[model samples]
Target chain A: MHPLAAVRGVPRRTWLRWRFAYLVLLPTLILFTYLRVFPTAWAFVMSFFEWGLVKPAERFVGFDNYTTLLSDKNFTTALLNTTIFAFATTIFSVILAIALAAVLARVVRGRTGGLLELLYFAPVLVPMVPVTLGWREIFNYNHGVLNAFLGIFGITRVPWLSDPNMALVAVIILSVWKQVGYNMIILIVGMRAIPRVYEEAAAVDGASAWQRFRHVTMPLLAPVTLFVIVITTIASYNVFTQVYVLASDVQGAPGRLVPVIVYDLFQNGFRFFKMGYASAEAVYLFLIILVLTLIQFRFLRGSRA
Target chain B: MNLRRRGMSRVGYWILVAVLALGGIAMIFPIFWLFSVSFRPASEINTVPPNLLPVHWTLNNFTVVFQRAPMLSYLWNSFVFATISTIFIVLTSSTAGYIFAKFKFPGNNAIFMLVLATAIVPFEIYMVPLFLQMNALHLVNNPIGLFLPFLVLSYGIFFMRQNTMTSVPDEILDAARIDGMSETGVMIRMVPRLLAPAVSALAILAFIQAWTAFIWPLLILNDPKYFPMELGLSQFANTGSSNFGVTSAAAVIALLPSIIAFLLLRRRIVEGITITGLQG
Candidate 1:
């Protein structure tokens, strides 16, 4: 017998039939353990220790790292900012997309909207570093296009990224711009899934277009919107690249209102070399995400009910 | 009813056309501005009345970007990472999908759910420990480090499994088996062609993901030479002057492959999203 056969037990006749399937599945299991299971479990253990990768020692500090996270001002700012950004991005994108889908769905029914799709999906196609940084340049204090446009109106420049109050808003707008198209496409697909027969029945009942949409379309579109909300909220929490590119210069002015949890963890672990502290943040982030997801499920179903 | 309906619908459709047209412009305007900004000379970029169209359109910034930075090297690195990883992803995911679709094995459902559950937690959850793990393995700061995270996309497998379950009928597999083919032989010969659409969609998704990936490469590879296009552009974003045109130019150049891929494989991309929507 092959040395590997020890893992699967003695090959009964029945086991021989399923051997190829297990053989094919070996790579998937190996990758799953390597990439996901091991790392995740390791992160949980590391969260408990005072394990700074920079330092030579890995002290077992117990709950100290987790407790310190409660009072870390930067950590506090990041958590608050992350929550706000996640909520705003998810809600804003979901609403705008459905609204766009509502209009574009009608348009597609009347005519093929291929051109419209290409145009809307441009952002999703375009890489983030460019679009977000490109917006950063446009939002520049002096020579930016937005300021230049405002120069036409004789309005003074607004420090879009530099000003702490405006920085999160700036990041939010750029994110909304990037992801709205993706949500719009998904929702448009959702809109198409709603049978035309229902609309025709509503029309026969002499319901106005607005009434038909309110009474007929909205309820049916709920499931897709919920999916969009969950995905977008998760995406919003993980907003790092755009922040790194756009708001890197914005120091803690209004405080770290735009520097989110991922950004915070990155700085702590990577830049500051505080691995254990960052791992604790990671643990918190995991809990927050798990709790929020559960809450969103309840909220979505509850709202519908 | 016909005349009234015609008038109302015509008005509604035109309103929609205008709305979508304007929204489309908003969507693509930043990229247009990036291209426009990139072509402008340093002085012209700061002109009093900012022209949406570049008055002095030159290849100065792009040329500067290529000359000043190791751009071609970055592109080459990105190309290698994306291509190799994409092939790995498609083959494994499709095979996994095929097995999950066709086979009845112990622990299969448990395994699939574990794969799917990982999709919710972003890489940030485990990235710190992953970094240490890579360091322990001496895989950090290497080219292999850059490609490590994408070794298996959980979502790709999930996407493939869904496609296979619906599309890859068992009749074809049994037909191949009945013809005196071995199991591996049947999988190798027959399954991939049938799963071509899922394969193509995933290829596009995975390639673009690897090509445009920044954080993993940034976190893993400390060496400048191994930096991919997005990380390369980020270097420009930070250390470069406020001239901004050059950085925008670099951004545009870096984005070219993904844009081209999107344009070429537009249908598969849409189909991928449609499947996602239908399942949702």
Candidate 2:
């Protein structure tokens, strides 16, 4: 009965179903376009101009912002810091998670295992701001618990947050502690999903426990391990809330000492009102993550083959 | 597998337990310190050797936290933002997911792929333009701006689509169609109940994300009255007069809702993360 339906020689029911599908998808598609697609395109365009927040001084800058970023010391620090943070966090968290999952797989049939899993996962549930705050107190130089504990060994208080090098290490430590549990759970699930027959066959072939795990369990877990690494790297590269909360005070690390990419973008975009430069930085961050993700896909496909 | 276990001595098993128990303690000690310090009296907070438990417990820090800032308002704002955004995310994701999974239409796979592609683009990449857009629309500093970017999550769409395909059967939908139920009627009546588990999982994930959001709220909101708990707590800690006890109390209060939610919906949350591969 519909005009298009009759013209296209389609059944009314089929046309109606298509109509219903489009009708259902329309609102979400429109929203996604407006909020996500449009803004992403706009950011690219804005990156090419000298965009500002306060003044109406927007003009085409012809890649000057990108060139300036080459000489910018702060941006360089942030890039280096983010790279270190990402690599350290990913490697440490992934290895520790695999170890924890391996142990738990052997002992996880009962209530005690569940309780331990929950205990490790508890930090993952608590909000980052508060947990970072708790870590800040522990990392405090004087009269803090960590310092007090170290004093027992007659090791003088280490300024965990104040020194630039130590501050990065402290951030990495916090990140690993918060993230290991989540990866552990994922790896545990991955380990469980491995059919037991392979391990059984290996054992029957006179493979020792270590030998079976090295060959059988490890190979199967490659995909999940790669997944954890990729996601952790991406997440770590976007680390902001912890750095912002932890380094903005006198008691905590100085922001300049613990510079990260998102913090750089936030500072440039919001604090200094340098929208154009910030967009360029955002594009750079996007490219790094994009490349990382593409590498992951390639690696995943390789492993599957 | 049993043979492998049989080779291990009893001593090894207990050693493993002891090591894991120690690791668990390390994992939970910071959280324990948070609550312990929060209950300490202000005088005891500055002691040279910090006691793991408060020497004398008092509720004065909580009272101080409430008095210093608009703590109640911050909690309310967070609740409203997280709840409303979660409802919209669940609704949009479920409907979009349902269509993508069940319906045959042109460009279905392409469109779904497009939506999923956006998940890989971090918010930091586009937030500059988004801020300008919000500013142009006069939404900055408004509560609506706090959650505008989050109302439609790409991950939620992918998650819901995967769930709908796995759980919702084609026969049931065809039967409903034959029963003369309008597509909208079928969706309204049956899809939600059928997809209840996935819906709850997505809802809790979205809620926790919105509730814990900080940087966007910090960027969009300047008014103290509009601050979410994250922003509020940050500001509280930044104030020069803030002390250890009071600040810890504020942090504890900000963390309470998530702790409560995690405890009540542990299995669902865990299941959701495992399925979706969502990191906190």
Model 2 Cα lDDT, one tens digit per residue, B40-115: 9989888888888998999999999988888888889999999999999999999999999988887899999888
lDDT by residue (A1-305, candidate 1, tens digit) is 55455566756644655687789989887987898888888888888887777662379889999999999999999999888888988888889888888867764544347788778877877778878878987887877888887877898888887876688888888889888989988888888889878877887888877877888888888877777888788778878888878886534222243678998998899889888889899999988778767866787778678
Candidate 2 per-residue lDDT, tens place, A139-198, comes to: 888878888998999999988877778778888999999999999999999898889899
> What TM-score would every model get versus the actual structure?
0.92, 0.96
| Docking quality class, candidate 1 | medium
Q: Which stretches of candidate 2 lie over 4 Å from their true place?
A: A6-9, A54-57, A249-254, B1-4, B278-280
lDDT of 2: 0.86
Model 2, residue pairs in steric clash: none
lDDT of 1 at A115: 83
Taking chain A by itself, what TM-score does each prediction score?
0.87, 0.94
Docking class of 2: medium
TM-score of chain A of 1: 0.87
For every candidate, what is the interface RMSD in angstroms?
A: 3.0, 1.8
